[model samples]
Target: MNNTVVVAIPATTANMGPGFDCLGMSLSLYNEIHMSLTPGFINIEIEGEGAEDIARDERNIVFCAAKRVFTEIGESCVGLSIKLINQIPASRGLGSSASAIVGGLVAANKLTGSRLSQERLLDLATEMEGHPDNVAPALLGGIIVSVFQEGKVHYLRVSPPEGLNAVVAIPEFHLSTHSAREVLPKQVSMKDAVFNLSRSALLVAALCQNRLEMLRVAGTDALHQPYRTKLIPGMNEVIEGALQAGALNVTLSGAGPTVIALTDGEKPAVNDAMKGAFQRAGVSCQVKNLKPTVEGARII
Candidate 1:
């Protein structure tokens, strides 16, 4: 048997339009975590993404997640060196933390003799991440629709349509998930609730069948984006620019400092337009032309 386990987990964009906490999809970018048993200690090393900002000690999220697994299974957590090769940007609303949680759990489970099934691993990952939207795709991959009900996760995975590309504009700043949620109203009007429900349903169905035309209407969200965009400067212009550049739909990726546009292969043009919009607004950003990935977290 292999003495080391490496888990490659994808980055995810959650809350796609009106789906709120229930919808998410995986991107091509990934974060990899490697683990090997040691004599008797816990050590964590990180590279890339949050290397300087993330903790190297037990306070690290990856270390904490791996430690949680041992505690959950009644085993002491020690004797492991976990290394994270992080690619997903932290606190950019791109599921960086979700990748870490899934990676840690999968690494621990693989080293512990695979005691949990994939579904169970997903549940554990969801528990650690506080929601299923991001972790669901990070662990299971593809476009995932998930709901946590009565302590169980129910989900459906859809393969992103062929010929579709994602143009992502990622800004340098960070947006805390807690801070983003803080601005949201505790109670929404019935009209707003119904608006979200219909849009969320349409977004899911249209994404599954590759109905590009439906996305324009389906992605009109009333739940979070309206409130969250207040935290993102020049957000409206960026969305309009992507639409003018031929994107089917543009939405905030997760709680967002990053925004993504769904396009029918005009990836580069859409990417440029988004960045230009931000630049015109005096904000600096990086852009990526990415495709959806079907593969989830796996040991290699």
Candidate 2:
């Protein structure tokens, strides 16, 4: 048996449109973790993304998540050495932390004899992340529709349709999830609730049926984005720009400083439009044309 395990975890975009706290899709970007057992010490190496900000000590999220796995199985792993090669941007609504948590869990599971089922690992990952939106896709891949109830995650994965892609415009500044959530209200009107519910259902159905045109209406939101626009300068303008450039739909990617557009045609134009909107707002941004991935975290 191999003593060392390397796991690759994909980045994810959560809360696609009106499906707040439930919908997400895995992207082509990935973070890889290389782990090996040690005698009695924990060693961690971080590269790329938020390397300077990520902790090297046991306080690190990856180490904490991995430790949780060891404790969960009642197995004593003396120590571990983990190297993270990260490509996902942290605090950009791109599921960077989710990738880290899932990476650590999957790598440690493999190192410890692969005792846990995917469902069990997902429950653990959701417990750590406080929600299943991001972690679900990072762990299971493709597009995930998830719900967390009674301390467990219930989810289903949707395979993306061919020829569809995402044009993501990621701004330079970091927007912490905590800060983003703090800006939202505790209660909303019934009319707003119904609005979001209808759209969320439509979004899921449209994705499933490969009816791309329906996304224009399905991606409209009344729950989070309306309030979140204040936190993200020029967000509405960015959405309009993408729409004008032939995007099927546009929405905030998680609790974003990033904006994403869904398109089956003119991807480059949509990318440019999003970037230009951000620039006009005096916000520096980078754009990436990424495809949805069907594969999730796995030992490689």
Candidate 3:
């Protein structure tokens, strides 16, 4: 088998509305990676995102993931050279890290003669990520609803409907996932739990059935967003403006510092309004219009 392995993984948005650590969807953005074996030495190269800040040594998540795969199979690898062509922004609530973990595992699996099945790979990825929301969708693509219980992941993938689009407003600042989760309450009331449950079910049904009206109610979350709002300035205003500008619903993308608005035909207006809201709040951000996808990680 050829030692050279190349893979492409997509960017994703997690915790869409009320799904909160359960729902995630893959976006059009992608990161391409190439890996090869070397002897007694390692070389790391990157083209975009976290080039200077990301670990260049064995501590890197990509390298760790690849190493983990080898360890799991009791195989010995001399060294590794990783080339990453990254497009997803780091710490932007856009699933950049998830893609990296997936890229490494997939490349190592291919180089090792595909010893592990995709299901096993998924479990490994989720374990590395500490949650299945982001990695599950990054591995399988599409709109994913996942439940992680007893070290196993149960998931359903749904294709996004036509004319249903997303506008992502990414702020200039970065909020690490650790910091974002720290702001969350240690425990939530049952009322909030039930609230999120009902909306999560609605969200999955609405996105699959193309019921735009349901999104407004389906996206509101009392479990996390309400508490996390304090971490993001002008959060409510941005959500309100997007809805007024014709977006069906607006919510924080993953943690905070980036906001996403769900739209149908008013993508441009919603984009403008989201940007304008951030601008009015004295925050600088970049906006992008992206379509959800059905593709996942694979070697080409």
Give per-candidate clash totals.
Answer: 2, 0, 0
Top lDDT: which candidate number?
A: 2
Which ranges of candidate 1 are over 4 A from the true structure? Answer: none
Tens digits of lDDT, candidate 1, 83-177: 88988889998899999998989898888888778888888888878889999998888999998977779999999888878888999899999
Give one digit per residue, the lDDT tens place, for model 2 in 127-219: 999999999999998999999999899898999988889888999999999999998999999999999999999999999999999999999
Q: Which candidate is the best by TM-score?
A: 2
**Positional deviation of residue 45's Cα in model 1 after best superposition, in angstroms:** 1.4
Question: What TM-score fits each model?
Answer: 0.97, 0.98, 0.97
Q: Evaluate model 2: give its TM-score.
A: 0.98
Candidate 3: residue 54 Cα off by (Å): 0.8
Pitting candidate 2 against candidate 3, the one with the higher lDDT is 2
Cα deviation of 276, candidate 2, in Å: 0.6
Clashing pairs in 2: none
Candidate 3 Cα errors over 4 Å, as ranges:
none
Candidate 3 is scored at a TM of: 0.97
Candidate 2: lDDT of 281? 93
| Model 3 clashing-pair count | 0
| Residue 6 lDDT in candidate 2 | 92
